[model samples]
Target: MPRTDKASRLIAAPPARVYAAFVDPDELLAWLPPGDMTGRFDHFDARTGGSYRLTLTYPDAGTGKTTTDSDVVEARFVEVVPGVRVVQAVDFVSDDPAYAGTMIMTWAVAAAESGTRVEIRADNVPDGISAEDHAVGLASSLANLAAHVEN
Candidate 1:
């Protein structure tokens, strides 16, 4: 059976600003990596039917899906709604069967009293990624996003 994971956060920024951070390559690089992982994009085309390739490197060695210290993600933009939502079809670049599949990642933002409420839902998550770890990673990414846009 497939699994789904979700996380949400209240950011101290307007919806447009928060949404911009999601599509801009530089801004995405600043906040998308969870914890100590750092990300760099091989290519980024933020539009419906477009795609991006991102490589995330872990702080520790030998803890990566694609390589010894990195995870390579190949993702396509399934939907892009300005100031509202962005959906991505993601795949992990790995030989492990447990990590082989398309995962749908939906990022939605809405207006709130203080700022914007951002939510992320990942469906059909790979079996190799533990639920607890994914939750933490999602939350961490949200925190990073908040810090990036709230400042």
Candidate 2:
């Protein structure tokens, strides 16, 4: 069984704007990242049973340059709560061999005094994936999301 790592972020944007990021492919393309990588959604249905694919491009970290061309990763929505929550399972296509199986990610959005509080509860992490790494990634991605919505 995979342990779950929960992460929360506060965004200055309202729940609606923050929620829009998950449903709007265009918004997703603008924010999903690790600084060195970015992605574009090929197709996103954003509803339960909906399947989607995103093409990710990673820049060479060593040289801080773009290295790999866009590559695809696919996912399917398991649940959805409009402007509030989403649960999905995602997997990557890897040649590195260490990466395998799908991971489940749940995104919950709540209205707050400042704006929106976004919580991510991720589970089914593959063997090679570390909790620390997931936390960092989720935090960074949330930061990116906050910035995106703020802009």
Candidate 3:
């Protein structure tokens, strides 16, 4: 069965600033990867129907990368609303069969008294990505986002 993972964070920034982090490639590369992973984009277009390919690599040899030391994802923009939300249809590019299939990921940003409330929701997650691990990854990414936008 497919799983769903969700994570929320209260970032010390406005909605537009927080939302820009996802729309801009440089900003996205700055905060999207979890842990010590570094990200590089093959191509990015932040409009509906636009697609991008990104590779996130770990310095070590055995970091969930069997074929290579990088986790690659190809994603298309399903919906993009400035300062509000972004919906992406993502596919993990891996030789590992467990990582196959498409996932729907949503980033929702809302105005708050002090800052913005950002929530990330992923649906139809493949079994390859365990819930526990996904949660940790999401939380880490959110924290990184907070740092990138808040600072």
Top TM-score model: 1
Error of 1 at 137 (Å): 0.3
lDDT of each: 0.96, 0.79, 0.91
Clashing pairs for predicted structure model 1, backbone only: none
Q: Estimate the TM-score of every prediction.
A: 0.99, 0.86, 0.96
- lDDT (Cα, tens digit) per residue for candidate 3, span 1-151: 8888999999999898999898999999999999999989999999999999999988786765434588889999999988799999999888887888899999999999999999999999988888999999999999999999996
Tens digit per residue, CA lDDT, model 1, 1-151:
6999999999999999999999999999999999999999999999999999999999999989999999999999999998899999999999989999999999999999999999999999999999999999999999999999997
TM-score, candidate number 2 = 0.86
Instruction: Assess candidate 1 and give its TM-score to the true structure.
Output: 0.99
Name the runs in model 2 displaced over 4 angstroms: 61-71, 95-97
Clashes of 3: 0
| Global Cα lDDT for candidate 1 | 0.96
Q: After superposition, how far is residue 1 of candidate 3 from its true place, in Å?
A: 0.9
Best candidate, lDDT-wise? Answer: 1
Q: Between candidates 1 and 3, name the one with more favorable TM-score.
A: 1
